[model samples]
Target: MTLLIENASLIMSVQDNGRFGFMRFGLPESGPMDWRAFNHANRLVDNPPDNACLEIGFTDASLRVEKDALLAVCGAGYQISLKGRKMPMWMSFWAKKGDLLDFEKTPGGNWAYLAASGGICSQVWMGSRSVYAIGGLGRLLQRGDRILIGKSIHRSRWDAGWFIPQENRPAYDIDISAGVVPGPQYEWFTDEAQTAFWQQKFNVTSRSDRMGYRLRGENLTHRTGADLLSQGMVMGEIQVPPDGQPIVMMPDHPTTGGYTSIGTVCRADLSLIAQAQPGISEISFIEINLNDARDKLTKTIEDIDKIEKPQEDVWTQL
Candidate 1:
């Protein structure tokens, strides 16, 4: 089976979970910006959580399913329709051959995903199907690209509906609060800067991308003489440069960095941060202990874990 891209989106790529153990070699784990949505899309179609998926960003696009296949669209800011009729998102839906699915962007989030029942087939690179374009690994999706579909886990279980509950979806609120813990260079920032960061609202600049989110807000002042060698960078690390503006690392952040990191956003909120609309979202940071950060991440993992196992087996109905 195959899926054909009729109208290409602004930024579309084939992505799995991500590559691992390669950052030390100067390669970042390039994957879907919103991990939660990506995972949910796969689970809706009974694909393994890390199966390859279509990552669509910020564009009005459409595609035609070459064959009858089970599919799902999960993300924000996109109105999905089939043959001029509206379709519900975050739920498994069957597409007949020659059916055209259109995605229209609205004003809430930046990214979305389309997952086939078995998952989109792609060659493995560094143990991942994710495209790391900059590294010359793979390239962005193009119009007319016909991607092959793999074997799905549930071939005939469409009798029951599957969807992500309202509570489980990403809250694309205009203003969001993200919790983080202090980083190694936290003390390097002035006391006033620390207080202001927690108190003031930062606007996400349009300059941000998959590599990092550039926040424009309080000017975080550091010790004038402070300087350090470039050190290993991690996802969620907050780095500040000569200007007080902070850049929160994202899934595609470089392996190393020179800017001092003031804090690390907890893994639990990374998806929230990713869903934030650049130039529109007002993000506030709150500090928490490491233990609390870990607990929150665990809870999020548990929540996603429950999605893979459907509450009631649709197979039972058949």
Candidate 2:
């Protein structure tokens, strides 16, 4: 089966759990900006949790189903419709041949996820189907593009719908407090700078992208004026340049950098930063220890498992 893109006002591309184990070769893991929503969308359609889905950003888009299929949409700030009838998000529904799926403008968040039964069929690059446009991995989807749909094991079970509990969804309208752990060069930053980082609120700038988010706030000063050798960079590393403005690296960030990093966002909060809309979102950091960060991640995983296999009535769960 195939899905045809009718219109896309902004960039939409394929993303999965991201390209892994190849960052040493200069490739950053490119995956869904909102992992929770992405995972929920897939689960609604009975796809593997890591199956590739459409990561829609900013604008309107429409798709036409060429065959009977099951699909789901999850994320904030967008409304969906099927053939002019309203369709609820964070839930799975069936569409027949020639059915149209429409996504309206997002008013709160910048990204959303759309998942189909089975998964999107695309060429894998370095063990991932994610579109790292800058790395020449995959291109932004365009109108008239034919997206092949893989054979879904749950296709026969599409008679009913599935939904994520309202309490489990992440909210983007409010200020986000991301958890952070000290970076390798945390001590290099001046005491005042360190204090300001945790005390002040930072606004995400328009220059933000998959590479990093440039925050506008008080400058962070380094105690030592000496320049250190460039070191390996990773996603969520909060690097402060000579100007003092911090740039929080993202999934498509470079493999290494020379800027001093005062801290790194905890792995669990990476998705929070990803969903932050540039120029609109405000962020703050809460310092945490490595052990606490690991524990939080474990708890998040456990919560997700419960969402996927709730003990409630299976037939009336949604």
Candidate 3:
């Protein structure tokens, strides 16, 4: 079984959870931008949480089902159609052999995910199929790529009506107010800069990519001369350069950053920022306490855990 790429998006690739244990050697954990959506898509199709899926970024894609299979699409900014008929997002649907599937961008988000009943088969490096082109892990998917299906799910108790509840899904609003915890260098910025950071809005500049999102807004001045030695970095770190424009480190960010970090977007709200597009999204961040942020993250994980957790594998039982 396979899915043939007819027209791939600008950035489409097979990504599992991420590559771990190599970050110390300058590799970034390049997974799906919306981890929650990615997991839900897998869950709906009876795949394990870390199963590899197709990540579609900021555009449209077209594929043909080479075999009869169940599929699910989740995340924001796109709508799916099977054989030219509209399909629901966050729900599992069946695709017959030779059925054409199209993912068209609508609005209000950036990344989308597609998962089949069986997980995708890809060459894994360092225990992950996630693509990190800069580090040579894998490359961007092309139009002619053939994505082979993994193990078959024997038909037993499979349900096609599985869907992620609305409350659990991301809002994907045009304007987002994300919550961030103070970083180690929070005090590096002036008091005015700190206040403005919470009050002023920033437009995501076109100078954005999988690496980082450069924001255009008020010039945040530094109190300590903005001289911070290069430090280890992670996803969602808000680094302000000498120009005062802040750049939000993404999944493919460098191993370390030299600029001063104002704060870090919390896990619960990081996906909102990730789904935001450059021109259409305006973002503001408010301070979140470490304890409260931890609770929010715990809640997000619990919500994903409750979504379509498979009961039992029919093949395994037989």
Candidate 3 on 1-318: residue-level lDDT in tens? Answer: 999999999889898998888778889988888888898899888898999999998889999999888788999989888888877788777777899999999887888899987799989988899988878878999998999988666343355656687888876788899999987788988999989999998899878888899999999999867768888999999999999999998889998978899999998888898888888789989899999999989988888756543334521221
Write candidate 1's Cα lDDT for 1-318 as tens digits.
Answer: 898999989888899999999888999988888888898888888787889999998788889989888888998889998777788788777777899999999888888899998788888887899998888878888889998999755555353367777777766687988998987898898899989989999888888888898999979999762357988988888898888899999888999988888999988888888878878888989998999999987777666645432556542331
User: What's the lDDT for all of these models?
Assistant: 0.84, 0.82, 0.86
Best by TM-score: 3
Q: How many clashes does the backbone of model 1 have?
A: 1
Regions more than 4 Å wrong, model 1: 156-160, 307-318
Error of 1 at 56 (Å): 0.5
Model 2 misplaced regions, further than 4 Å: 156-158, 308-318
Q: Write the per-residue lDDT of candidate 2 for residues 227-303, one digit (tens) a residue.
A: 57888898889999888898999877898888788899987787788877777888989999999999977766655
Which candidate, 1 or 2, would have the higher TM-score against the true structure?
A: 1
* Candidate order by decreasing TM-score: 3, 1, 2
User: lDDT at 249 for candidate 1?
Assistant: 93
Candidate 1 displacement at residue 146 in angstroms: 1.2
Clashing pairs in model 2, backbone N/Cα/C closer than 3 A: none
Q: Give the CA lDDT, 0 to 100, for residue 153 in model 2.
A: 66
Candidate 1's displacement at residue 200, Å, is 1.0
Which lDDT value does model 2 have at 202? 89
